[model samples]
Target: MSPVCLIARDEWRALLRNRAGLLASGLLVLLVLVASFTSLERRAAIEADRERYQASVDEQFDQQPDRHPHRMVHYGQFVFRPIAPLAFFDTGVDSYTGNTIFLEGHRQNSANFAEARQSSLLMRFGQLTPAFVLQTLAPLLLIFLGFASISRERERGTLRLMAAQGVAARQVMLGKLLAHGVIALIIGLPAFLVLSGFAATGAAGWATVLPMIAGYAAWLLLWAVLSVVVSGLFHRSRDALAILIGVWMVGVILLPRVLPVMAEQRTQLDTNIETEIALHRKLADIGDSHDPEDPYFNDFREQVLDEYGVESIEDLPVQYAGLVSIEGERLTTGIYADSAARSSARENAQNALVHDFSIISPLIAIRQLSMTLAGSDLASHYDFLQQTEAFRYNFVQRLNRMQAELIPGIGGEDPRISAEYWQEIPRFHYQAPSPFSRPSDLIWPAAVLLGWLVALSALAAWASNRLERNLR
Candidate 1:
């Protein structure tokens, strides 16, 4: 047998004989199983709740009492962003972003019910998902299992004995790495299986599932290589374990939280209240539709008369007041959209700053990658907002157009368009972006994770060379 193969077998045997190692590995496998089950259940519950709410809201829109189109605009529609199918595996920034949005004419509302606002600070610790398990907990488990792989051998003078017996140091290091890499794979198995099961069952697509698997595999292997390198470099097993744990805490736990806070602090976005006030101010600056003598309306009235070749609004083919209302709504909606775009830009800037730290911490990269793939990231939220805005504009304008065309034909002191027009208005249906359609968002994070894997592999190779020199 090859020296590397013999060394690998002996190391595997030693790992099996270590009762504590077996127990730790067993516990991690169990934890992964538990996390998978809970995550799947949690996702199902959230999906059902959101679906139920959506149905209720749709019903409410359909059952509205007879009212003016403008009144209905004030009543507004409620849009609920659906939870992505694979969100169960990695909730990512879902908890931080608001899920419910109120859509009305002339104003843009912030998403109202963010999970962060509802939950306790304990949420900041992190949610229990496959991503969380693999990113945060799996590394610690790998370190515990393998931190003593070479350090313990050196401490007990077994490394020297192995070297004297014609086993090369490189072979010994490679053997330990192979054994523990298998252990890391085992630790990550249950989560991977759950993710695969989700894909198999059609809850997630292969596009998302494959990239997630690859990213997580890279993450775990990076930690495995890191563990072996640290163990080989350190003279004492205890020092190896302590150093590895410290690194895990800082990289996995501390940085994800701190970077977000810094990002928010650096890019201070306007509060929703401030945004709404600004929008209202902009709208008021434009002439009011209700005032017949308003300058903007006067000019608009002349324009309408010229188009129709009529001297007075009443002589025209359409209702003059309704045309003015439509024009007014157009102006207000335009301002609202501009304000919304500005706010979205600010939020993107904050997220971009956080993404910049992905290079320093792969956890941020993986978290961003997971969320983006799952369709629960900020970009998805923005898409929902933009779609809802479009729907609101369409619904409002259709009603206004009804008043313009229908009210004039039905002429009266207070012309009322048939309530049946409401039935003809189309309902809002949200269309989520497909996984493959959004590759740019996922690319940077994947690149960061792969970079970490390459860097750590190089470090491991360097550490092995040093171990070879010391043994000779």
Candidate 2:
């Protein structure tokens, strides 16, 4: 056997004999398996509930008796975000960002009833999903198992003895990396298999899932190399362990929390109340329908008359009031959409800052990559909102069109429309955001992760060379 392979085999045997290593690995495996099954079940339950609610809402809308078309517009509709197939693995921002949105004419309702808002403070710390396990805890586990790999040999004088036996420095370091790399792969295999099974059965996209698996594999391998190199750098096992723990604490635990706060502070965003007040002011400036002297409405009235070849709005073919309602809705919808666009831009700008700093914490980069692939990120949620908004516009306008075309011609006291027309109006259909479109979103983050690995490999080489000379 090659000397490097021989040393690697020996290291693997040592790990098997180490009780702490064996026990930790076992527990983590169990945790991941449990997480996998339970996450899927939870995901399924949420999906079923959303589907049920949507069906019920649609039914209620369809069953409405003869009523004024404007009244039906006020009846509104509900839209629920569809969970991506791989959401069980990542969950991402789903828990905090409400999955359901109330969509109505003249108003953009907030998404409400999020899980985190209902849960106790303990839930704020973290979730127990597979992504959480791998992102937050698995690196710590690797640190515990491999932190002492080279340092222990040095502390016990075995490293000097190996050099005296004519063992090469590069071979010794390669053996440590190989041993820990195998362990990292072993540690990640169960979760990968679970995800792969999801992909194979068509629960998730194969292209996205394959890349997800590769990202995680690279993440684990990066940690393993760091652990082995840190061990090589330190002469004392305890010293190496301390440094590794510190790195884990800062990189995995501290920075993720801190950086977002920093980003938010840097990019100021308006509160919901402030945004609503601003919207109201903008609408007020656009002219009130009730005020006959309002210049904006006067101009709109002229346009309507000219369009229908009539001298007065009252003499037009359609009900002037219903025509006015349609024009009013168009103006309001435009202003509301503008506010929404600005709000979305601000929120995304804040997130952009955080993503830019992903290099400082590779964990954040992996998280962005993970969430993007899973289709459970903020971007996906935003896409849901956009789709829902567009649907709401079309739906309300259809009822307004009904009022303008059908109700004016009937000339009844109630000014009602046939209930059958309700069924003709479209229901909300959420178009799942395509992961394929945002390959650029993953590129920078993945590059940051790869950069970490390459930089650490060079440091590992330098440490190995220095260790070789010191022993000689």
Which candidate number has the best lDDT?
A: 2
TM-score of every candidate: 0.94, 0.98
Predictions in order: lDDT: 0.81, 0.88
Which whole-number lDDT from 0 to 100 does residue 223 have in model 2? 93
Query: Which parts of model 2 are misplaced by more than 4 Å?
Result: 289-295
For candidate 2, lDDT tens digit of each residue in 98-184? Answer: 888887777777778888998889987788999999988899999988998998888888888888898988899999999999999
Q: What global local distance difference test value does model 2 have?
A: 0.88
Clashes of 1: 0
CA RMSD for every model? 2.0, 1.3
